[model samples]
Target: MSDPHATSPEDVDLSRFDAIVDVRPQAQTRPHLPESTFTPLERLLEDPAASLPSTSARVLVVCDIGMRSAIAARELAELGYQSVTSLDGGIDAWRRHGLPLAGTDSLTPNELERFDRQIKIPDIGSTGQSKLRSASVTVIGAGGLGSPVISYLAGAGIGTLRIVDPDVVELSNLQRQPIYALSDLGRPKVAAAADSVAATTTQTATEIVQGSFDSSSAADLIEGSTVVVDATDSFQARYDLSDATRKAEVPLVTGAVYRWEGQITTLVPNGACYRCIFPSPPESAARLDCALVGAVGPVVGTIGTLQATEVIRISAGLAPAYAGRLLMYDGAVGTFSSVSVQARPDCVCQRP
Candidate 1:
């Protein structure tokens, strides 16, 4: 007989379940069934409304053992999920039964081998990787933050990458933009960034748009992207992208870096926006740009890496950490902190 608390692998029909929601801690290593969606237990416990999708489709919850899965099943049930079940014995029982399992879904032989390690992640299974492969991300600026953002996103298998930048690679750019080499000097930054994206993974296709990000073109550039990344140093560019993205109702991941400090945050359509925190630009003379204030390569790299990480999480259909929070990194002190934010009542972004 099946256990009263959970259903055994033999009793659970995978074909009947529309989706499997893994609620284990990410540190635990377990081979995930193909097409499974990962939502860490803590995330679900803290905010199930945001972490979980609003689906009526039947979902099976699983973990290393049945304990966490049972908890997740109960949480879903309490949330009014019509049909929620726990996989008895979790993945361990499933594997012990010699049942059919797929590490990833819709992956070609080469892709399967290429992303083998990533495919093993319970939350990012084949479906998540497929999402990554089908996503198109546009990154504005190919400078400090853009370099690592472009490189890592491409390496993560972002299928379509559109690099937009009006500047040309310079000898000084080599310090922070390692994606370019000495030979790239004098060449358009978009060209070098596109080339770097191509070299990272054969699965990713690259596009180059040579233009500065401004009010007029920001909307057009961000229109069709799966995600828009703001990697520019200018406040004007950041404000322009923020306004355009908010108006477009598209997700925006913006990053900024000073000499030893950097900040990153994601602005979803209905959530807090960049303007909520800073309604107006800093005083004219008080503004600082990387060119004038200078920056350490690693500081920008840290912020860029975080930006890329958020992009991947967004692509994977996972909630981003910075959605309602601003993450600040202090390279000089080696510390990271975050502050919560909300949409201001009178903010223009609140308008429908």
Candidate 2:
């Protein structure tokens, strides 16, 4: 029999449910079933901190074989629930018992059409889409890397974009930066990028700051921006962004792409600042700009895409997340690796 007491992970405290399903019948079933929605241990660990059915939760655990379900139920015992029981015959039993599956009729007509794609995803539905639409992001450059960053940020429905770049477009930028066309050759990077936002995603308001973004400008931008994407290529620019965003305690999604190499790192206040990672400028600086060197189209695309993903996730309230971690990508080999970030004890602390 299904228990009347069902506790979800969102229910912070137990004492919510009155009945719990017994999983004795689950043990007799097979290990796996074709139609089961039950999540495997590996899948659960992949999203580490996602709330699951707590053993103390009064949830009616469904399993193909009640045996495994009961076993999994015990995993939530320490969560302070009173029950983590399973169905008598699992989902099969629930079916035989004539329990009705929830219907989609609860959705409004427009909602059903608007969120058709999101509704299909398990965790992200209308709720997540709304969160995404209301997200605010700040892009710390409107040049090469920022081009893709701004385009995708707008396409993603970021409610607002604050672009910080003091440069203008030039003929040399045509090779890699496509956000600006030849007609926009002389326009400031921020102005041209803002125009792109209006043309594509009018819903996202673009604010262009014509001045350079130093420690002071960074503070104002970080104040209301939920996420900051560092598309700046220069080491000095990256360091300034790191120090300033860290001081403002904003999450910084920093990315840089050269010929075929790219790197991304997400930083918060206590995160390892770029200063901590690249403690001092290289003995001899590598002033390699595509104008001087060259770059592949997809290289910046891949890196900027990663930065966009991090920003969306930060705005979406995800946890067990990326902070103080550097992710490096090599488009040539198509390999990606990551390492943890740490504070530099020898470095001077700079505030926003």
The lDDT for every candidate, in the order shown, is 0.83, 0.64
Best by TM-score: 1
How well does candidate 2 score on lDDT at residue 118?
46
Task: Give one digit per residue, the lDDT tens place, for model 1 in 1-352.
Answer: 6544478889887788877778876622335666677788878767766655564767888887788988877777777877778999887688678666565355776775687677667577667788899999999989999999998888888899889999999998898888999989999999888887767788999888998889988777887888999999888788788889988888999999888999999999888888887888877423349898889998999999999999999987778879999999999999999999899989887776
Which residue pairs clash in candidate 1?
A: 38-123, 105-126
Q: Best candidate, lDDT-wise? A: 1
What's model 1's TM-score? 0.73
In model 2, what lDDT does residue 124 have?
Answer: 45
Per-prediction TM-score, please? 0.73, 0.65
Task: Give lDDT: candidate 1, residue 172.
Answer: 87
Q: For candidate 2, write residues 147-215 as lDDT tens digits.
A: 888887687666789888888888888777888999998889888889888998556898888777776
